[model samples]
Target: MVLQLHVWGPAFALPSIDAQCLSAIAYCSIALPKDAWELIASSDPSVSPTGELPALQNGSTWVSRFRNIVDYLRQYSDGAWDLDRQLDESDRADNTAFASFVESRGQSLIDLSLYVTSHNYYNNTSPAYGNLLQWPNQWILPPKLHGAAKARTDHLGLSSLDLQAIEEHRQRDHSAAVAAGKIPKNLIQRPRETVSGLLGRGSSKNQFRMEALTADFFEPLEAMLGQKAYLLTLKEEDVPSSLDCIALGSLSLALVPELAFPWLRDAMRAKAPLLSAYTERLRRRCFGDSPVEVAHAYSPQSAPASPLPWRAPGRISIAAVGSTLLAELADSTPFLSEIRRNNRLKQAAADSDLTSVEKGAVSMFADSSKKDMYVSIAAAVGGVAALVGYMFHVGLISVASQEQEFEEEEEEGIPDFGNLSAGDILGL
Candidate 1:
């Protein structure tokens, strides 16, 4: 089936900013970063159904959200890299719990880092979408996404304190008046409250929120991952778990240099070595540090990069072929012919002599030794052809195989992480 994944793209992995989308796209079989993301965004609402990016359209099936998308992908790929493929029921439950916990605690912090934090937003996240686009899109998209993202964060009462504080104060006054047996009026006219007077966070609280949320997330992760390869390892020596995929996809954004919050990044760097190590391990295991994208655009400056185009997997592109098709052809035929002629001249210098002006005037035999040299040249051409063809095959296979890096293992499982309260896990 033709699998087309529509996500915000041209920047970050899977081409969009959302980490949940990253996890889902990472699990798909035929997933490639779609370059014309704005096209998808501008199209019908039915494309997404939920009015969200990262919607996957597979045959007749359509789904949104990372968890549901992954469930579908597991079936689609026949359990390839399917975390729940061989796990027992209990482990599966625990996996769900862990994912829920991480999402609850970490997703907000991610939003704060990208949308709310001024430093990271302009430097990394806000401008990211536009930077990936061509001229008009570059002009149009950043403001739209920025406005949408800011509106959501503003509603959280974290960023727009004045507005939230005003609303809250008005509500408080109305409640007070109703209790005192008078109808509330002119509450908003006074506008006496500052952000500090309300429950909404101010500058100090925003900083504290960053630190607190950072602590809430990584502390548990560090303890849960103590000296282990996998998050919910069945044995002490298992590779990364399904939970690891989600965790990595979510937390990996913090390490993103542009999107990274300086305070939170430092906190993770200083206090959460294990969690830091976990993301590093997952990056290597899942991506091998490479993803192939069909998207024509890439964000070298502000967005995430596409997997670099390559002539082969192991072979370097420059070594395999020249930059252009004509250049490559010249290198193979004319270039090879010139090299053979030079080699013959070098041998003659050491043994016999050959005239320098043997060409262009004396009527150089087009093929004086054509019959004998035909076999040798033909063999040389065949060797070069085999090398190119093999490299092409290798590149094709590498691109396909890389879509899903983690394999479904049989007859093994990861250890369960029992339910624990936030305070107990974070040591708060």
Candidate 2:
């Protein structure tokens, strides 16, 4: 059976919106032959065994995340698919270091550009996700992604990029003031500020900060690449290593995508032209220069064939949708919401290497056994049923009883006159 690599659907003229997904795509396209594997834009994380995307399905087993996928591919079929096997020990160490660097710093840069900035997120990133997802999913996935981005870049102290962050801080201060029985500032309301207007105020400062961030990521890669065709090998004939795939994935997102705030792209072109060119050159070589349009809404039918292996998402599993809905509902409930928040805080505080994307998926029943999880679900369902029942009993909600329905059907069959009494009713 052919291996299936499931990922988020294409958006912003890229194979995948996510950096990790793009990394996985590049690796697979290089490692596996054209007929050996197919790409499916599932756009659903629940399809993965690990509840994430860029999942590689080989027979019954599934592998998730770029690093894990790389490891799996390297070992598959007795090392037939290993891209880095040709590397010497020193080059291999460099590969490991560079890959990690790209994943961390590159991810931060992407998040800051696409998601951390309120203007870019609202006008570009969020809409890109919306185009990539179905109805309910489009609503849920963007905020979740945005939150993950915020968490990842929070340590960088670039709150000015997100005007909403300023608003949130204001709200918190107001709440504190209210609790302390103190008057708040600016009781008189002014006109609501546009994000563009606010952004105009700090455009230069934000530009400098964004450039600094992007340079930190791109400069080292440029120096490493130098004049070589790829990252690792110096000869013109050397095949691009796994590190090249990772770097290409990261840089493509940074350089591609015409965002509302095009600071990242501008920075790359100005500060690191060679790296930007390398990203574009590598992407074109792998996926062709033709613009890959977003596929139609997911269907059971296969996606349209192209130079690149873009496939429509498989039929969404009902179970996966249900799981997503349940998770969202749990987050909305007060007690469960608190627990979920605490779990996220704990995960954030823990010294784990999991990325923000990986860390945010806090299980609703993280501490509970399967039985307890089932019981909780059942209780929630039962409570909803009981609440509806109580509403009907108190006349807040009304429904015709079966007997009343039957009586109405009989009456409709034979008309009853107000002037006629019991005899007329009997005749009817």
Clashes per model (N, Cα, C within 3 A): 8, 0
State the displacement of the C-alpha of residue 362, model 1, in Å, after optimal TM-score superposition: 92
Q: What lDDT does the true structure give each of the candidates? A: 0.56, 0.78
User: TM-scores, in order shown?
Assistant: 0.51, 0.73
Residue 164 lDDT in candidate 2: 78
lDDT of 1 by residue, 1-428 (tens): 44556655535543346676556544442233333112122211223545455677766766776776666767766776465665678877878888888876677667666665655666666556554444344554566556655665564546643243346767787888878978755445555544334334356665575566678888888888887777777464454456776787677766644444355567787879878877766665444454423243232333233332111112224422232333334435854555555544443343222356654222234334443467778888999999989988779767656654534332135433467677877799
The model with the greatest lDDT is 2
Q: Which residue segments of model 1 deviate by more than 4 Å?
A: 10-15, 29-50, 77-81, 134-144, 151-157, 160-206, 234-239, 259-261, 290-428
Query: In candidate 2, what are the lDDT values of residues 1-428, reduced to their tens digit?
Result: 78899988777788789888888888888778878888888888878766678899998998887877888887776788888889999999999998889999999988888998888999999988888787579899899999989999998867677877777777787778867878756465445455556657776775566667877887898898889889998875777889999888878888888888787788888888888888998898766675555653244244444445555565667777788899899989866776666665554334245566555443323544344655877899999999998988887644456667888889899855767898767886
Best by TM-score: 2
- In terms of TM-score, how similar is model 2 to the real structure? 0.73
The runs of at least 3 residues in candidate 2 whose Cα sits more than 4 Å from the true structure, single-residue gaps closed, are 167-208, 296-307, 333-428
